[model samples]
Each structure stands twice: as C-alpha cells, then as structure tokens.
Target chain A: MPATLAEKILQQHCDEQITGPGQIVRCRLSLVLANDITAPLAIKSFKKMGAAGVFDKDKVTIVADHFTPNKDIESAEQVKVCREFAKEMGITHYFEGGNVGVEHALLPELGLVGPGDVVIGADSHTCTYGGLGAFATGMGSTDVAAGMALGETWFKVPPTIQVILTGELRQWVGAKDLMLALIGTIGVSGALYKALEFVGPLASTLSVEGRMTMSNMAIEAGGKVGLFAADDKTLAYAAAHGRKGDKAIAADAGAAYERVVTIDATGMEPQIACPHLPDNVKPVSAVAGLKVDQAVIGSCTNGRIEDLREAAAILKGRKVSKDVRTIILPATPNIWRQALAEGLIETFMDAGCIVGPATCGPCLGGHMGILAGGERAIATTNRNFKGRMGSLESEVYLSGPAAAAAAAIAGEIIDPAKV
Target chain B: MYHGTAHTVGAHIDTDAIIPARFLVTTDPAELGANCMEGLEAGWIKKVKNGDIMVAGENFGCGSSREHAPVALLGAGIPVVIAHSFARIFYRNGFNMGLVLLEIGDDVSKIHDGDELKVDADTGVINNVTTGQTIQCKPVPPFMKGILDKGGLIPYVQDRLAERA
Candidate 1:
C-alpha cells in the first residue's frame, strides 16, 4: 500500500501494524526538546514520574532562548531550574547563554533534526522541521518528559491534506505570502489535526529557508504539521547543516490524501495578517499607510539568513522612519555571525535599526522592545494575536521580511513592490 | 450537585489570550491563573468562582502549544470546559492534566454566561441547572478515560513504567 510523507516517516519510526490516520501507535523519537519556559515543568514532571534519568542525554535538549538574559526574577528562576536539571542530569544538548537561539531554528542549524526522523518539542513550531521532511509535532512538557524517560511516545496518525501549488511566484512575493494566503483562504481550523503536504510545481521552487518559514506557521492554521517532500533542496540543507542521517523521504505516487486544495501564486503581492489573528490576511497594498510605531524582522518564523538578506536588500542605505523603532536579530548565534559576515547587520545598523543578541524576546512579549497601549507594529513574526507583543490594546501586523523592513523605513505598512 | 457556573467566551480564544507570555515567566498554576484571560478579558478572574466551567465557541485554545493555557484555566477553578471544538494541542494538554473537556458542538449555544451547570464525565452529559436543558457531549475515548481515572497522564505513565519494570 502507498503512504503519504507523514505516514511513511511515522511508520519508519514505529511498528508496521500502524496502518493509517486516526490509529494510535507507539513510535520511537529521534529528538526531544524543551525551552527554558517549558523545561522547568518537564523536569518537575520527570521527577514526579520517578524517572531517575533521561533515556538518552544526547537526544534530550533544552534551550534558553525564551526569556533569556532573564526578563525578571521569575524568568531567571525558570532558567535556573533548567540549568540545575541539566547539570544534575548531565544532558549533552543543554544550550544556554550565547549558544542559544530560537529552539526550532537552532535545532535545525545544529543538525540535530533532519529528514525521516520522528521528533517532538515542547514548542508548537516543532512542526517547522517538516520542511526538511522530518515528522515532527509539538507536545506538552509532560509528553516531553515521558518521551525523555521512555525514548518513545504515542501519536494519533493524522490524515493528509495535500496542498497543490502551481503558477510562478511574482517578484517580492515569497513563501510567507503563499502561506498567509493559504491560511486566509482556508479558515484557521481548516486543517485541524491534519498533515499539510505541500506538493506540485510551485512547491518545488521554494528554498529550504522559505519552506521552513512556511512550515513554521502550520500551527497557525491548526495543522498537526506542514510537510515538504525531501527533494534536492531538502537534501542539500541536511548536508549543509552537517546531518548525515537517512536522506530523502517522499510520499508514494499513489499516496492517500484526505482532501486536496490548490494554490496559485502568480501575480501575488506580499500578504499581511492583520491584528488579532493570523488568518485575517490582507494585501500589503490594502493596509498601506497604516502607521506603525515599530517594526521587527526576525523570529523563528523569518529569522534565517535568507530572511535577513531579504530585509537587508530592502533596507540597504535606507533609514528607519525616526518615529518607528526597528529591531533585528537573527535566529541563532551562527546565523547572527553569518548576517554579520555578510554585512547585513551593518546595513540594518546604518538603517537605524536596533541590533540585539539572538533571543526570542520581543516576539512573544518577553521583551527588548514592547509596544504600549494603542500602538501598532509590523513584524515578520508569527501570530498577531492580541497582546502577543505587548499591551492588550496594542496591535501587530504580520508580514514578510521584505515588507516588515520596508515598513520600518516607511514608518507604516506599505507595498514593498511599489516602494 | 453543581459542577460550576459557566464563564463564556467567543470563538477562537487563543492560548495567548488565555495566558499571555508576559505571565509565562512562571509555570506556577496560581501565578498563571491570576492572569488568565487578562488579555482577552481583564475582568475574567473576577467572574470565575471555584469549580466553575468554561464555555466557548469553536477553536477554543488555538495558537501556541503552551500547556499553561489549560493550567491557567485549571488554576482558576475551571475543572471542566465545554466548547464547540478545541484546537488539538489544548485538547491533549487538557487530558494530560486531568482537566475535563466536553465537545458540545452546536449544543454549546445552550450555555450562557453565568449559567449553572452540572457535568457527568462518564455519560458525557452536561446539565444546565438554570435553564433545565440537557446537552450530551461526545464521549471521551476509553483510553483517555483510563488516563483520567488515574488522575492524569503522570500516574498513567507511572503505571506503564511499573508494568515495564
């Protein structure tokens, strides 16, 4: 019988008896991850379960990217718990301080996650790895604790939603727009509990970085995961990241899909998710001239080097509108260094943007630059939900890196292609 | 017996609205609960009483995999929730912590803010004591029932570990 990329990757890690969607099965994990905010709770549950130690220290990783530099006493205490637990358990993959990055981006850059692997993280964006053809999903910290102790966890197989992509993307329009348009077209719960497999001619054109950005928003559409086939781009990314694991996994030609949806990207413009919901997408042109108090161009969603390069190309020799605050940080320390080497940092700095250390702060309101009541920001981050980046009355507009950077220069949401 | 009063919210009540990341600095239930729905409704905590039930429309608990969402509700004395549907992660997280969730589909409209409700987990029935209306929910799966019977996933995991030992 033929199987989908999700099915095939899952079966590779579990028993053969697990046939299809909705059937629960036990599967071994290649990696288990938690962040500073989550690791403390997982450690509490691990001790509560009376698990003496982790099943494999190398397979278990904890990152301090969230609220790092210690936002407050409570935040510091949370990381302190993780640090003490890491010391006590002697975990091989405990990353803190300067080594840290956003968990999803940092893991892929370090080659700890790759194609055909079964992975879980305490963060929702864990599904971001599916861009590399890995079968990954987010779990609660208790589930992470269980996977740490048992080296395996249970999954209720999800049916596949095959998204057929066609037509060529226009200039200044990229994967972020394609994904936002899909979410806007399909309601937030359109893919609930389903694996979104991006297939067809247009999908073949997206870069590995673009694909990761697309997959990172799968959760925004309520998808269990968003997946891409392990094509050449996927293999090249795996190799570049130093991963030597099993290479190339794809769906069978006759693979089963629950439903099919088609997206054509021709003549598209940059898309922006309006305040309060990611699915509330509108064209940048529609929202142009909407004043913003700030602009942020990085997160796990769009914090890669390519994303930075896109922003830099737009901001080179330009200045952020003096009224708007622009903050740019790469996803990982390595990515940060790469951006520095490429002078993207200098371009941003020259553009009057605030360059910060690699941290997930400000993206989720942990801090660095938070919005005040009634203010607005155009960001390249995911989720524009209320209070996501600051005060309850503050608003966030989500856009592609190019548009976000352009908005910083314009001091308002603008059509980048036009400007 | 009274299960709790209903604290109703509209559709697509996301995790961030439940417990914002600003309060995620601590995983302590009380700390999280104190700020529960602070973003969505600043006065939400003042409305909830012990053992209250949360009622919402479709896609409640969408966005983010933070289990803190359910923990905050649980800490606010919301031992049960009734919704048209739930985002998948919050559903799993709720069960993992022994917080009962009932899917009433269209029947969720039968519940109004401040309604008195009594819930029966075994039969998946929700009784609106105020309006005298009864709502039958989709039964929680047997395996999940097994987990809830043991108080939560931790104890269930403990049982499995014992069996392996």
Candidate 2:
C-alpha cells in the first residue's frame, strides 16, 4: 500500500509493524522539547517516576523562552527549576536567558531536527518542524516526562486531509494571509484529530519560512499535524542549516487521502483574523480604517528573518502614527543578530518602533506589550481569542508582517496594497 | 461511575480562558483552581463544588499546550469533561492528569446546564438523570484506559520501569 508522508514517518518510528490509522503504536522519538512554563512540571514528573536519568541527554532540549527575563518572582523560580534540572541532567541543548529563543524557531536553525523524524514538545507550536518534513506534535508535561524517561511514546495514527494549493499568491500577500484564509474556510474544528498535507504547485513554491508559519498554527484548526512534503526547497533549507544525513522525505504518488480540498491562491488579498476567533477572518478591505492602539511583528508565527525584512521594507522611510505604538521582535537570536547586521533593527527604531529581545512575551500576554482596557492591536502573532494579549476588554487583529507594519504607520488596519 | 450536575459552555473554550497567562506563574493546582475560567466567566470558580461535570461544545480546551488548564479544573473538583470534541493535545493531557473525558457528539446539546448526569466510564454511557435520556459515547482506548487505571502517565511509567527492573 502506498503511504502518505505522515504514515511513512510513523511506520519508521513504530516499534512493530502497524496496519493503519487508529492502531496504537510505540514510537521512538528523535527529539523532546519543553520550555520554562512546561518543563518544571515535566521535571517533577520525571523525579516522581523514579527515572534515574534521561533516556538520551542529547535528545532532550529545554529552553527558557516563555515569561523569560522573568515576569515575576514566581516566573523567576520556575526558570530556576529548569536551569537546575538541565545542569544536573547534563542536557545538551538547554538554553538560558539572553540565549533563549522560541523553541519552534530555534531548534531547526541548530540542526536538531530534520526530515523523517518523530518529535514531540510540551508546547503546542512544536508542529512547526513539519516544514522540514518531520512528524512533530505537542503533548502534555507528563507525556513529555515519559518520553524523556523512556525515549518512546505511543500514538494512534491519524487519517490524512489533502489540501492542494494552486496559482501564485498576489503581491504583498504572504503565508500569514494564506493561513488565515484557510482557517476561515475550514472553520476552527474542521480538521479535528486529522493530519493536513499541503501539496500541489503553490505548496512546492512556498519558502521554508512560509511553510513554518503555516504549520505552526496547525493546532489552531484542531489538526494533529500540518505537513508539506520535503522537496528541493526543504533539502536546501536543511543543507543550509548544516544538516547532513538523509534527503527529504516525500509521499508515494498513489498515497490515499481521506479528503481533498483545493485552494486557488491567485489574487488573494492580505487577510486578517478578527478579534475573538482565528477562523473569523476577512480581507483587509472589509475592515479598513479600524483604529489600532498598538502593532506587533513577532512570535513563532512570523518572527523570522524574512518576516522582519518584509516589515522593514514597509517602514523604511515612514514614521509610525503618533497614536500607535509599534514593537518588533525577531523570533530567534540568529535572526535578531542578522537583522542587526542588515540594519533592519535600525530601520525599525528610526521609524519609532521598539525592538525587543527574542521572547514569546507579548504574544501570550506574558509581558512586554500587553494591552489595557478597550485597547486594540494589530499583530503578526497567532491567536486573538478575547483577552489573549491582555485585558478581556481589549481586542486583537491578526495579520502578516507587512500589514502590521502598514497598520503601525496608519494607526489603523490598512490594505498593504495602498501602502 | 460518578454522578453530578453539568456546567455547560460553548465551543473553542481555550486554555487561556481556562487558566489565563496572568496566573500561569505557579504550578500549584489550588492557585490555578481559583483562577480557572476567571477570564471567561468571573465568579465561576466560586460556584463550582466538588464532583461537578463540565460539558462543552466542540474543540474544548483549544489553544496552548498548558496542562495547567486541566489541572485547574481537576483541582476545582471537575473530575470529568464531556464535549462534542477536543483539541488533540488537551485530550492527551486530560488522560495524563487522570481527568476523564467523553466525546458524546450532538447528544451534548441534550444535556442542559445544571442538569444531572451519571457517567459510567467503563461502559461509555452518560445518563441524563434530569431528562431520563441515556447517551452513548466513544469508549476510551485500551492503552489509555490502562494509563488512567494507574492514575496518569507518571505512575504508569513507574509501574512499567519497575516491571523491567
């Protein structure tokens, strides 16, 4: 039987031969990840289980990214727990403050994950690695602790949903717009307990960074994994990251799919996920001139070098509106350093934007740019559920980097075509 | 088997609403219980008592992979969560924390807020005592049931490691 990309990876990891979907199989994990918020609990579970040591010190990665540079004394204590555990266990990939970046963005850059591997993290966005053709999913702290101790976990194989993309995206519209449009069409729970496989012409053309942006939000649609077949772009990306081993993984031509949906990407306008729900999407034209008190361009969703460059292009010679405060955060330390070398940081600062460190602070209302009562913000981050970035009285509009930059200048949601 | 009053909510009740980020600094279950659902329905914590069931629409516990979301509810004496569907991570987290969940589909609408329900985990049955209607839910898989029997993944792993030794 021909297998899908997800099936092929699962079969490779499964301890015994598997028949099909819904079969429980034990999978050997290539990587296990947790951040400050989730790692402390995982560590406690590890100790309680009487596990003498991590199954493989090299396979476990812990980073202090969320609530880092500690938001409060309690947060400070949490980081301390993770730090002590990492030191005692001699975990190879532990990242401390000032060195930490969003785990989803930083892991691939460090060549810790690659195609045809099964990975799990205690953070939901762990699916981002699917851009590199890996089968990665998020689990709870206890599950992660078991994986850390045993080096293997169980999974019930999921059916696959094929999403075929055709035609070229319009200018100024990027992956963020494409993803928002997809969620809107499918509703929030459309892909519950299923795998979403991206294929066709447009999928092959998307940059790895763009693929990451799409895969990172797979959870938003209630998907198990959002996958793109490893092609030339994927191989080149892994090679650039210094990954040297196997070539990219691809599905058999005759692989079966539970359902197929085709999306035409031509002339699609920059889209926005309105306040309260990610699937509540509309084109920028529909909500034009809606005032914004703040604008943010960062998070694992769009906080890459390419995203920063796109925002920098829009804000190069323009000043932000006096009523709006703009903030830019590069997703990883490498991206931040590269942005500095390219003068993108200076461009943002000269345009009246505040540049923050590589942390997930403002994205989850952890800190940094939280909103006040009745405030509104345009951001490149995922999730705009009520009170997602601050007070329940506040609102958030989700958009791509370029649209967020343009909104900062106009102090309102604006069509990037007009910028 | 257990019986309780059902407290209902709509779809996409996210983890941020279950236990908001502002209160995520601590891992203490009691602290989390006090703030659970505080973001969505203030004073909900005060109303909840021991042995209540939470019934929700599709995609319950969506957003973020915070186990604290389920911990908060469990701490507030919510031992079971019944929904039309759940986000994948949350489903696994609930079991790992020894919190029971039943996926009852459209039958969820038949049970109203404050209605009495008697849930039987072994047989996958939820009986609406108030309306006298019985709904069939999908049974938990054998492996997951084994973990829950051991009171979550930690003890399950401990037992397995002991067997190996």
Candidate 3:
C-alpha cells in the first residue's frame, strides 16, 4: 500500500508492516527527553523496574529549564533529581541548570537533534522537535523510564495529513500567521491524531527559526506531530548549528497523503486565535483596537534570540502602552544571556517591558504573570486553550514576538506592519 | 484498587486537562495526579473514587504525547476510561501503563457518576449495577488484552519480543 511520509517512517522503524491506525508496533524512537519535572518520575520508575543504567546515554537528553532559578523548594528539589540521574546514567547531552533555556530551543541550538529522528520528551511540547523534520512528540515519565530501561518504544502508526503552503507571505505575516491561519481553517480537532506532513514550495521558504515557530504549535491544532521533509535548507541549518550527523532526507515525491490543505499565504492577513481555543481564529482586524492588559513575548515557540531581536527592534525607544503590561522571557538562560550581551534586554527595559526568568510561566499558568478576571494578554506561546494562560475568563491572543511587542506598545491588537 | 462507581466526561479530554504541562516537571505520578484537572474543570478530583470509571467525549488523551497522563489517572485508581475515541499516543500510553481504555460510541453519555457499575472484561459490557443499564464498549483487541492482562505495554512488549527470540 502507498503510505504517507509518516507511515513510511513508522514502518521502517517497526519490525513489521503497519497498515492501519491503532495497530501497535514495537518501534525505535530516535530521541528521548526528560527535564526536572519528568526526570524524577522517570528515575523513580526506573528504580521500580530495577534497571541498571539507561539503554543509550546519548539517545536520552535531560534538560533543566522550567525552574531556571529554582523558583521554589519543590522546583529546586526536582532539579536535584535530574542532575543525579544524569550522573548515574552517564547521559551525554545532559544540560545543567542555567546552561540551558527552554528544553525545545536549547536542543537544536546545541545541535543535538536532527532530521528523521523520532524524538520524545517528557514535556508535552516535546512535539516542538518536529521542527527538525523528525517524528518528535511528548510522553510521560513511565514512558521515558521505559525508553531508558529499553531504548525502544511502541507506536500505533498514524495517518499523514498534508499541509501545502503556497504563495509568498505578505510583509509582517510571519510563521505565527501561518499557524493561526491553519487553525482557523482546521478547527482544533481537525488534525487530531494525524501527523502533519508540511509540503510544497512555500514550506521550503520558511527559515529554520520560522519553521520551529510553526511546528512548536502543532499541539494546538490537535496533531500528533508536525513534520518537515528534510531538504537543503535543513542541511544548511544543521551545518550552521554545527550538528555532526548523517545528511537529512526528504519524503519521496509521490508520498501518499490521507488529506491535504493548501494555504495561500498571500491571502492571509495577520491572524489571532481568540482566547480559550486555538482554533477560534479570526483576522486581527476583527479583534483589533480591543483593550489588552498584558503582552507576553517568549516560550519555546518564539523565545529564540532571533525572536528577541525582532521584538527589541520594535520595542526600542517606544514606551509600553500605559494600560498594557509587556513581559519578555527568553526561552533559555543562554538566550537570555546572549540577549543581554547584545543589548536587546536593555532595549526592552528602556521600553518599560518587564523581563522574566527563563521558564514557562504565564504560558502554562505556572506563575510569574497570571492574569486577573476579565484581563486579556497577547502572547507568543503556542496554545490559548481555556485557562491555559491564567484566568478561565482571561483572553490570550497567540502571535509571534513582533506582534506581541507591537501590541504591548499600542495596548491593543496592533499589527506589527502598522507599527 | 478502585473502590466505587465511574464518572464520565465528553471526548477529547486532553492531557493538558488530565495533567497540565506545568506538572511535567515532576515524575511522581501520584503527585502529578493531584493537580491533573485543576486546569480543566477545577475540583474534579474530589468527585472521583478509586476504581471509578471515566466515560468521556471523543478524542480522550488528545494532547501531548506525555505518558504522565495515563500514569496519573491509573495511579489515581481510575479502573477504566470509556470514550468515543482515544488519542493515539494516550491510548498506547494507557495500555502500556496498565490502564483500561474502552471505546464505546456516544453511548458513554448513558453512564454517569455514582452509578454502581459492573464491568465484564471478557464480554466488554458495562452493567449499571444500580440502574440495570448496560453500555457496549469495544472489546479489547487480543494483543492489547494480553498487554493489560500482563500489567502494561513495556512488560507485554518485553515478553512478546523476548518470546520471539
């Protein structure tokens, strides 16, 4: 049977030919991840299984980013468990505290992940690794522990739904626009349990950073993983990051697709997924000029150095709107340090933006920027599902960092192009 | 072990609601389960009982490939989860973690919390022990049944793959 890119990959890694959905196959995962929150659990499970050591120290990556400064005693204690496991397991790519940023961002920046690999993280957004053209998704601690105990996993092969992007994006219509526009067309559950195999000429045009922004939010669209076919651009990105690995591979040109949706970027204006649901998308014009209480620019999705640079450029010399509280959080401490060295931090501070520690705070309602009743904030994070950011009634508008910065200045939904 | 009647929710009960991303930092499944539904419908934890059934809407375990989701639920003593559908990963994770997941159609709405239920694993029938009502759920596939019968996916896979040798 002709199979989609996702099916083809799953079969190759499996011991047999997997035909339909829900057929379990013992397959090999290319990458496995754990952080402070998940590592402790994985380690606990490992102890229960009486596992001697991790299956392959190099395949598993443990990163410490969620509680960078060790927010509380619990977070501080979580980091301790992760560190001890890294030492005991002899893990190769263990990222120590403060040396890393968001687990998703820091991995690629450090050149540890690459194309065609099946990456799994204990964190939900581990799907972010799909930006590298791999089958990366999130998992739980026992699963991570199993991966450590035995460097393999079982998966039910999923069907592939193709997303073809054509036409050039208009000015200020960045990757965030593409994702929001997609969610607009395909409701939140439209792509549920399907692998999003992004294709077409326009897909190639997206910069690595931009592609990461799109793939990071695949969860919001209810897809298992968003995949890119490895090409020259991916290879160049791999080289630029100094990743030493086999060359990446693209999908066969005639790969089968269960469904296909074409997005004309030129037709898309700036978009905003309304609060409470990522698929509740509309043209920014529809929601523009509305009052906003906060604007956040950071997260594994758009909190890269490049994202910071773009945001600082917009925020420089501009005062944050009196009614809007602007917050900037670098994805990782490394990105934070680099931004400070490059003066981006100073530029944001001069613009009256409040900087936050390198953790998922307001994005997941962990802390740092919880909203009050009826408050609304524009953020660059992935999901805006109800109560995802703060108050169930509080609205969260998802966008790129540029739009977030611009909105902070205007105190409403201001298009970056206009700013 | 679970002690009481099962409660049901609609399909697509996502991992974010079952166990939010904020709790991904810790691996202790029990601790994570405590805050599982705080992000979704707060105070849902108090309504559950050990061994209670959870009937849900479509696409249960719909978000994140996180394994903590099923672990949290299983550790919370949720004996079985019946939904219109289950997300691919969560379905696998639940079975792998020894949690029972039944795919019944919209009939899941027929079952409610505090209804004494008797589940026949061999027959795949949920009897409302209190109301004498019965809902049909998909029979567990033989392979998955073997996995569940043996505790979880890892042990099942380990045994099956090892036997092949």
Candidate 4:
C-alpha cells in the first residue's frame, strides 16, 4: 500500500510491519517531552512504576516553560518536583529559566527533534513537530510515564486527510490566517482521530516557521497531527539549527487519502477566530473596529522570529492605542536575544508594548498578563477558548501577528492590509 | 457491568469546559474534581454522583491535553463517558486515568439526559434502562482492555515490568 508521509514515518517506528491505517502498532519513540505543568505528574507516575531508571535518559527532555519562574507557591512546588526528579534521574536535556521557552518552539530550535522521529509529549501541542515531518502526538502524563519506563508506546494508526494549498497568500496574510481559514472550513471536529497532510504549492512555499504555526494548531481542528513533507526547506531549517543527518520524508505518489480538500490562497485575507471556539473564523474585514482591551503577540503557535519580524514591521513607527495594553512574548530566549539584536524589542517598547520573558504566559492564563472581567484581547496564540487568557467572561480573538499588532495600534481588530 | 444515571451535554464540550485553566493549578485529582465542568455549566460537580455516567455529542473532551480533564471527571465519580466520538488525546488520557469512554456515533441521540444506562465493558453494549433501548458500541481493543483491567497504564506497565522481572 502506498503510504502517506505520516504513515510512512510510523511504519519505520512501528515494532510490527504495518503500512495502513487503524493497525495497532507499538512504536519506539525517539524523544519524550514533558513541561513543568505535566512533568511532575509524569514523574509521579514514573515513580509508581518502580522502574529502576528511565529507559534512556538522553531521549527524555524536561522543560519548565509553562508557569516558568513559578506563578505561586503551588506552582513553585510543582516545578520543584520536576527539578528534583531531573537532577536525581540525571536527565541530560533538562532546561529551566533563561534556557527555557515554549517546548514546541525550543525543542526544534535546539535540534532535539527531526524528520522520521516518533515523538510524544505530555503537552497537546506536541503535534507541532509534524511540521518537520515527524510523527508526534500528545499523551497523558501516565502514558508519557509508560513511554519513559518502556521507551515505547502503542498507537492505532489514523487515516489521512490531504489539505492541498494552492496559489500564494496576499500581502499581510500568512500561515496564521491560512490556518484559521482552514479550521473554520473544517469545523473543530472535522478531522477527529485523523492525520492532516498539508501539500501543494502554497504549503511547499511556506517557511519552516510558517509550517510550524500551521502544524501547531492541528489540535484546534481535532487532528491527531498536521504534517508537512520534508523538503529542502525542512532540511535547511534542521541544518541551520545544528541538526545533522536530515532525511527526506514524503508521501508516496499514490498514497490513499480518506478525503482531500484544496484551499486556494490567492488573495486570501487575514483571518481571525472569534472568542469561545477556534473554528469561529472570520476575515478581519468582518470583525474590524471591535474594541479590544489588550493585544498579545506570542505563543507556541506564532512566537517564532518570523512572527516577531512581521509584527515589528507593522509597529515600527506607530504607537499602541492608549486605550489598549499590548504584551509581546518571544517564544524562546534565543528568539528574544535575536529580537533584541534586531532592535525589534526597542521598536515594540517605543510602540508602548510591554515585552516579557519567553514563556507561555497569558496564553494559558498562567501569568504575566491576565484579562479582567468583560475584557477583550487579540492574540497570536493557537487557542482562544473562553477564559484562555484570563477571566472566564473575558474574550480572546485569535489572529496572526500582523493583525494582532494592528489591533494593538487601533485598540480594535483591523485588516492589516488596510493599515 | 455498571449501571448509572446519565448527565448529558452537547457537542465539542472541550477540556477547558471540563476543568477550566484557572483550576489546573493542582495535580490532585480530588481538588480538580471539585471544580470540573464549572466553566460550562456551573455547579455541575455537585450534580455528578458516584457511578453516574456522562453522555455527550461528538468530540467530547476536545481542546487542551490536560490529563486533569479525565482525572477530574473520574474523581467526580463519572465511571464512563459515552459520546459520538472523542478527541484523540482525551480518549487516551481517559483510559490512562481509568475512565471508560464509548463512541456510539449516531446512536448517541437515543440516550437522553437522566436516562438510566447499564454499560457492559466486555460486550460493548449500552442499555438505556430509562427508555429500554440498546445501542452497540465498538469493543475495547485487547491491549487497551488490559490497561483498563489493571486500572490504567501506570499499573499496567508496573505489572508488565514485574512479570518480566
């Protein structure tokens, strides 16, 4: 059987010879990840297993990205659990404080993950690695503990859905807008338990960062993973990040697809997902001029250097509206330093933006910025679920950095092209 | 076999609705259960009794991969969740936390809120005692059944390691 990119990768990792969907396979994981929020529970489960030690210390990476610096006493204690466990276990890749960022962004930049690898993380956005042609999925803490204990886990191969992107994006439109439009068309649960393979001209043209933005939100559409084929762009990205031994992973010419959807991106407008559901997408033209109390431009989804540059271009000489508070977070410390070197940090500060540490921050309502009652925000994050950024009554509008930056200046949602 | 009264919800009841982000500060299952479903329908935790069943439309437990979602439901005494389908992570998380989940497709509409249900894990049959209607569900795969039988993946792995030793 001709295999999709996801299936082809899984076949290599599967303990059994399987080439099709729905086959139960035990896969040897190349990497297992857990963050401060999930790792403590995973360590507890690992201890409960009474395992002498982790299956492979080098393959396990523990990061304190969420609630970093500790939000409160309870959060501090939770992180302490991970720190002590990592130290005692002698985990080689443990990262905290200045070295930490959103795990999804930090891991790839550090070359800890690459194509054809089967990775599992306790964080749901683990699917982000699929941008590099890896078969990565999120599991629970206990499941991650099992992976740590046994170095392998089981999966029921999922059918594949091909999303063919044609034509080029219009000015001011990027992957965030494209992904929001795709999710709106598919609805939240359209691809439940399925793999989404992004292909065709537009997908191929997307930068590695753009592909990460798309793959990171595959979960928003209830997809098991969103995959992009490894090409020159992918190999170059891996090489730039110090990764060697990059392999090309792609779907066979006649791979079976359960369904195919083609999106024409020619002249596509910047899009936004309205509060409460990621699928509630509308073009910026539709919701423009709605007042916003805050604007955020960072998360695992859109906190890469490319996203920062886009936002900096829009906010270069303009000041944020006095009525709105704008918060910007670089996804990783390295991205932060790069932004500083490029003077993007100074430009943001001149625009009345508050640039914070590289952390999940307000994206998870953990800390740094929290919306008050009845407040509204525009953010470049994957999720805008109710109370995702603050008070349950507060609303979040999801968009690309351009739209988010424009919203900060206007104190309301606006079409970036019209800016 | 287990019998329970059903508490129902609509499609896409996400994990944020199951246990909002504000309550994710602790890993204690009991602490989480006290506030489960507070985001969607307030005071829902009070309504859930031991052995009560939850029925919902498609994509139940969608959104963040917080294990707290299932741990809270299990802690709140929901023995099983019957939905049209489940998001992948939540399905696996539920099993890892020892929560039983059934995917009943279109048959989900036949079961209503407050309906009494008897679920047989071995046969994958759900009997709506209130309406006296029976709906068949996909049986749990052998490997997953073994995990559930052992009370979740942690114990399952521990037993496997013990056997090897």
What DockQ does each candidate score versus the true complex, computed on alpha carbons? 0.79, 0.82, 0.43, 0.72
Write model 2 residue lDDT over B1-165, tens digit each, in one string: 979999999999999889888888888898988898987877787877789899999999998999999999998889999998888899999988878899988889999999999999778899999999999998888888887778778888988788767
lDDT of 4 at A397: 96
User: Which segments of candidate 4 are over 4 A away from where they belong?
Assistant: B149-151, B159-165
Q: In candidate 4, which residue pairs clash?
A: none
Candidate order by lDDT, decreasing, is: 4, 2, 1, 3
Q: After superposition, how far is residue A363 of candidate 3 from its true place, in Å?
A: 1.8
Ranking by DockQ: 2, 1, 4, 3
What does candidate 1's lDDT look like per residue over A1-419, in tens digits? 79998999999899757688988878999999999888888888899999878888899999999898788998899999999999898999998998998888999999999889899988888999988888889888888888888888888889999998889888778889999999998878988889999999988889988888888999899999999998878888889988775578889999889999998888788999998899999988899999999999889999999999999999999899999999997989999999999999999999999998888898898899799999999999998999999999999999999999889998888888755
lDDT at position A170, candidate 4: 85
Query: Of the candidates shown, which would achieve the greatest DockQ relative to the real structure?
Result: 2
Docking class of 2: high
- Which regions in candidate 1 have their CA more than 4 angstroms from the true location? none
Q: Candidate 4 has what TM-score?
A: 0.97
Residue A7, model 1: lDDT of: 91
Worst 10 residues of 4 chain A by lDDT: A14-23
Residues B1-165, candidate 3: write the lDDT tens digits: 233586766555777688776676666668877776766787787777777777787778875566778878876767678788787668767866767777887777777756777777567787877777887787777766676778774565456445544
User: Candidate 2: where is the Cα deviation over 4 Å?
Assistant: B163-165
Fnat values, one per model, are 0.71, 0.79, 0.37, 0.66
Of all native A–B interface contacts, model 4 reproduces a fraction of 0.66
Cα RMSD (Å) between model 3 and the true structure? 2.9
